[model samples]
Target chain A: MSFLEVRDLSVRLKGGGPLLRNVSLTVAAGEVRGLVGESGAGKSMIGKAILGILPRSVEISSGAIVLDGTDLLTLPPAMRRQRVGATCALIPQDPLTALNPSRRIGPQITDRLVDILGWKRAEAEARARALLHEVQIADPDRVLRQYPHELSGGMRQRILIASAFAAEPRLIVADEPTTALDVTVQKQILKLIAGLQARHGTALLFVTHDLGVVSKVCQSLSVLYSGKVVEDTDVARFFAGPAHPYSAALLAATPKYTDPTAGLNPVPEAVIAAVRAEVENG
Target chain B: MTLVRTLLLRLMTTAVTLFGVAVIVFFVIRVVPGNPVAMMLPPGATAEDVARLTALYGLDKSIPQQFVIWGAGVLHGDFGTSITLRQPVLALVLGRLPATLELSVLALVMAVLMGGAAALTGTRLRETRVEGGIDVANGMALSVPDFLWGLVLILVFGVLLPVFQISGRVTPSLHLPFVTNFYLVESLVRLRFDLTRDLLAHMFLPAFALAIPLAAIIGQLLKQSLKETMHLDYVTLARTQGYSEARVIWREALPNAILPTLTLVGVQFTFLIGGTVIIERLFSYEGLGNMAIDAVINRDLPLIQGIVILFAVIFTGVNLVVDLTYAALNPRLRHG
Candidate 1:
């Protein structure tokens, strides 16, 4: 069985429209699956629903988030939390806002282990220090004592990544983790995440708008648009050529280093309309 | 080092602020058509007698000269003597200050507890009917002023049920070992639960009246803050840690949420202190507010000046404490 399988999931606002439309995806152990889409494509919602952190505004209408052979939807809320917490974690979008500014870095990273895992404070702290070291953070002791505001954006993201990996979680949903960093810092963070995933052999559901990032790190790619998965293909198959016209338009839209002049092509209106109609039809 | 500098700077600003309040009060009071000397004299008193009394109290001098003399006296820890009471103005104000302080403290505690509970309840039950109910309650509580609430409380707790002492700080008949003016603190320290209960019986109505609006303000602001903080990324991250919603709200969201509320409460508290005058009068409570009213009615210039200055000192002191507290609660401020 896949390490993480989201089967026929659907989510909608409490009294409003749908946010995710019958989404389904899987990530086998030690694999990276890039969920790529535009801003409002509900790429993040899939991750949120799987992790049971959907906002109060939205509710999962029908979904089964099967993590490590257990269907989370079938479990009670407390048990679902326990199951998810034990096996899965998230690396969020904005590093600056993701670490509570009022808190010290040490406690923010160590809290999951202490609170959810019921580890001793000493053990958690030691683990946090080692995790920080593994993330290539210099002077882990001083960094631990510092507040989020004291660290740079890159530094905060690194801490978050380290925190996500600290518990040895089997699956981590990287929700556009590098989107908030500088272009230079983004490469370093991406490399670090990919390196850690390889070393830990954890399944990763990488959510991003950057197809270039997918080509670099993802083994497989799923192109999502307007709360629906439009295309799902392996990295080689996806890059060598895409079968879906929407996927082709999306790849064309991403600026390439080899063909800089062809870079800024807006995804064709025809393709978006056709795909949007297809989504509405079902 | 920054904190010391901040306090020293705050103290300097406070001195300047008090001087400004003194100047305004001295000149403004003199501008008012009434003369304390005329007010003091009986109906049969002659003009010569008024002049003599005015000169005796140094009210015959120019307003600035009078201020300099009063200011010098104040610098020497003397606020002259009250024209109406025939006592040192400084002594009277100090004597009445602690009662107001104790009442204000009780009101603040009550506000925080009641308001915090309402805010937490509203935040926890957001998008639900309960949250809407809390919002409505907060609005109702805030719309009415404290003195009006005092009257309502008196009507309910005093006149109708008559369960609490609605007029005084403690029972008149209770033989009390009163070492300090802080009856509440002293009673608790002495383990005088009976005395404490009696004092609370008297204090409860007035304190609750004062707290109701402040509680509403706190509830509204804190709940709004909590809602905003709930949408913040850190809170979402906290939830993804597999902690319960309550745990996330309390630990992750509340600290940030409480900051704005603290600022509002700090500013509102000074207004609360100033508000005590009408409240004290409504309840016939022995506080500085009651004295302030009497001082104003009698045109007791020296006493009024003294009371206003004391009020100014308390205001500045509360602001200082608030700033220090903000620093302590916020890690950026503490470490920076």
Candidate 2:
């Protein structure tokens, strides 16, 4: 069995349509997986479900999520939380949203290290400084002491990544970690994640809509469409020759830089024509 | 820091406007035209007696000179002699000042507790079906005037039960820190549980009355701000970080939401002092509000001017203190 195995996971929100339906995937130890989909395709929902961080109205209708061979669905909330912090950590999309705005960045990062990672205050502080430096943040000490608001968007994102790494969890689920950063910073953050994952041999569930990023970090990829996984395959094979029709259409949609003069390749006229038919039927 | 600057500018505007209000009130009182000489004289008194009295009281002096004399008296801590009380205005104001201070302080405590409890309950009840009922109660409490509440309280606690007195000296006062020397002295001489209850009882009605408006205002403010804070991204992040729901609310949401409430509390301090007039009169609780009332009714010009100016200064001072607190509690307001 994989280290973390999700079997037939389904999620539905009250008053909203099904967010995820019978989506199943697995992550082995030291493996990085990419869950890719268009917007509103339940990619983030899958990340949230694994962590038991769903919104109040959403329910996991049917699923068995086993972490380290223990069913995550069977454990109580408190136990689940303990496992989450100590075994897994989440890096949310926006750094500002992820960090407490009122707390100084250093204490915010170090406190998590001490509390969840069981590092002493001094050790945590030192680690926090080093982590900030590791993330390429300038004036690590000053940035650590400053509030999240005082730092630029990219700086805050780096600080968040440092805090996530402070936990040293077995698995890290990064939900659009690089979305809020600029192009330059995004690449840097991704490289940092890749380096960290390699150093620690940590499994990662990298959730994003950007296929280029998925191609960079992931060994396996799951393509979701309308609350279901349309394709799940090894990243190399899938990218080499996508078998699913939707996957083919998505790949075709990515603009080719080789032909700059050509208008961006639109999804094939046949695929669009089929979607229009489905909508018209309802 | 910019938020602090914005708050300071608003406070300064409030202070300047309050000064203008004080000046206008000063002039308007004098414009009422009946001479103190005519008002004080016996109906059968001869014209000579009236003329002599007018000169003695400086009623014959020009309005600006009278104002100057009144202002000087204010600066010198002499608000002239009260015609009705047959005492110096300063003495009367001071005598009643302590009582009003006690009432206002008690009311502030009560209001904070009441409003805080209501806000906490309302915040919790938001997801429950009973939220509408609690909202209605808050609205009702907010809509009713303070004096009317005092009257209702008197009827229930005073007129009916007759168990607790509706109004009088703060009964069986227990020592309060830094405020009442007598209570502190007594408490130090002998520590007793009975004294505490007596003090709490004495503070009950007026405090409850004063607290109604404050609590209503605070509860509404807290509930709205807390609701907004709950929606903030950090709260969601805290939950996702494997923190418990209670910890998320207390550690993350409460601290972030409380800054505005603290600022409002500081500003409310001044409003409480101002609002206590009707409360003091209704319960006959001696306080600054009561003193202001006596000054107005007795046409004690110097006393009225002094009380108004004092309140204006205190209000502005309280606002400045609140602004400083904002910088302390909210890092976003400070680090910038």
Candidate 3:
């Protein structure tokens, strides 16, 4: 079994049909796993389930999210939160709103460390300052006093990344972490995440609809469609030669900067047809 | 320059509008029939006495002359003698003002605390049937007028329990707690805790009546704002960041949700003034509402005008305070 293993995980929304259907995944120790899917394909849902942060409407009908030999689904919410902070963390999609707007950045970062990790305020604050510096934020002390709204989009994203890194979790979930940033900022954030994950040897579940994002950091990739994993492969195999038609289409759809003369590739008819059939069935 | 310009403009507009309304209300009062001097006179007085009374009361003057004299006196800080009290109107108002102020302030404090507590509970249980029931109860309580609620409260707390006095100002023997012994520097001041309870008991009818509508409106506002705040990206991130439900809703959600309610509080404060009239009459509690009604009935134009001006000033002051609070709660409005 992998270090963190999910088996037969399913989520059904209230008054709605299955959101995830028997989806399973594994993240070996210190490896980056990519989850690629369309907007409603339950990529984020999988991340939420792993962290035990599912919405009130959704129920884990049948699943076992085993992290380092413990069944996460069986733990109480408070215990689960402790586990999440010490063992795993989530980098949410939009940095612009990922932080509490009413609080200064430094206190926001230190609060979690003091409560969840039992780090004293001074130690936690020092850690926060160091994390900010690591994330390349200029004038870490100044940023500490400033509210979320005071920072630029790129700066906010960096701060969020530093927050996720602050606890030194064993596993981190970056769910479209840089999707809301500009292209240049997106590259910087991805590089930052990649570098941090490498240095700390923490497992990463990087969820994105864009295959290009996964290609940079993921050691392994899983392609999902209609709440099912359609393909699972190593990064080199997945990109160099994709097995699933959906995977191939996703890769083809992704724009390439090196080949500027190449026109955009239209989406594959097979994937489109499959998606249409799924939509029509519902 | 910028702040002063805006403040000047706002003051000018408010003053002009208040002046127009005051003048119209003044004329409307004058047009109504019963004479102040007549109300004052004994039944079998002579025609010469009535004439002398009219001249003495300044009722014999032309409308413009009367207005000029009244307005000039107001400018010079003189609110003429009251027809009923036969003392300077300002002195009478000032004397009675503290009583009304004490009642209004106490009732408002109770209303804020009760309405806030109820709103917190309601929003916390919004998904449950109990929350729905509480919401309906709030709406029903609010829909019934303050006088009716006051009567119901009086029946329950006053007649049935017999714990509280039915009608009166603070018991003359009762001294307020905490502030009585300022001379004792080292020790904490002695307090009559029972007196505090007694005061609150007396406040029950008026405060509950006032708080019902405020709570209903606040509950509705709170639920809407909480729902919106919960949907915001920050809240979602907080959840993923592992904040407990209470922390997420209270610390993260409630502060942002309170922005709209601050505006509502100002408008409701004005409503409270209007509501006091029926409540005071129903309970036979002496307050500004009762005084204003008496002045209107006796057709004491100067007293009515003075009371009206007092109310306008209070209403404007409440609005100014609310605006200042709005700037504090919402950063966008601060500089703007």
The candidate maximizing DockQ is: 1
How many steric clashes does model 3 contain? 0
Q: Which stretches of candidate 3 lie over 4 Å from their true place?
A: A271-282, B1-18, B44-46, B172-195
In model 1, which runs have C-alpha deviations exceeding 4 angstroms?
A261-266
Error of 3 at B298 (Å): 1.7
- TM-score (0 to 1) for chain A, all models? 0.97, 0.92, 0.94
B79-195 per-residue lDDT for model 3 (tens digits): 787788667877666655555565666667776776677667776676898778877877886788777778788898888987766675445576554432221111122455565
Candidate 2, clashing residue pairs? A106-A144, B100-B287
- DockQ of every candidate: 0.79, 0.59, 0.50
**C-alpha RMSD over true interface residues, model 3:** 2.0
Chain B TM-score, one value per candidate, order as shown: 0.98, 0.83, 0.89
- List the pairs of residues colliding in candidate 1: none
Candidate 2 whole-model C-alpha lDDT, 0 to 1:
0.77
Q: Which DockQ-derived CAPRI band holds candidate 2?
A: medium
Model 2: per-residue lDDT, tens digit, B1-336? 576577779878986777586667778878975455566677999989988877776767887788778767766767677665667866666666666666777788788888887777777667675656667777988898777888888899887877666775446353444344344234445665466456555557777877887888888888788878877767766666677766677777777888888888988878788878888788776677877887777676667766776677667767777877788788765765
DockQ: the better of candidates 2 and 3: 2
Rank order by TM-score, top first? 1, 3, 2
Answer with 2 or 3, whichever has the higher lDDT. Answer: 3
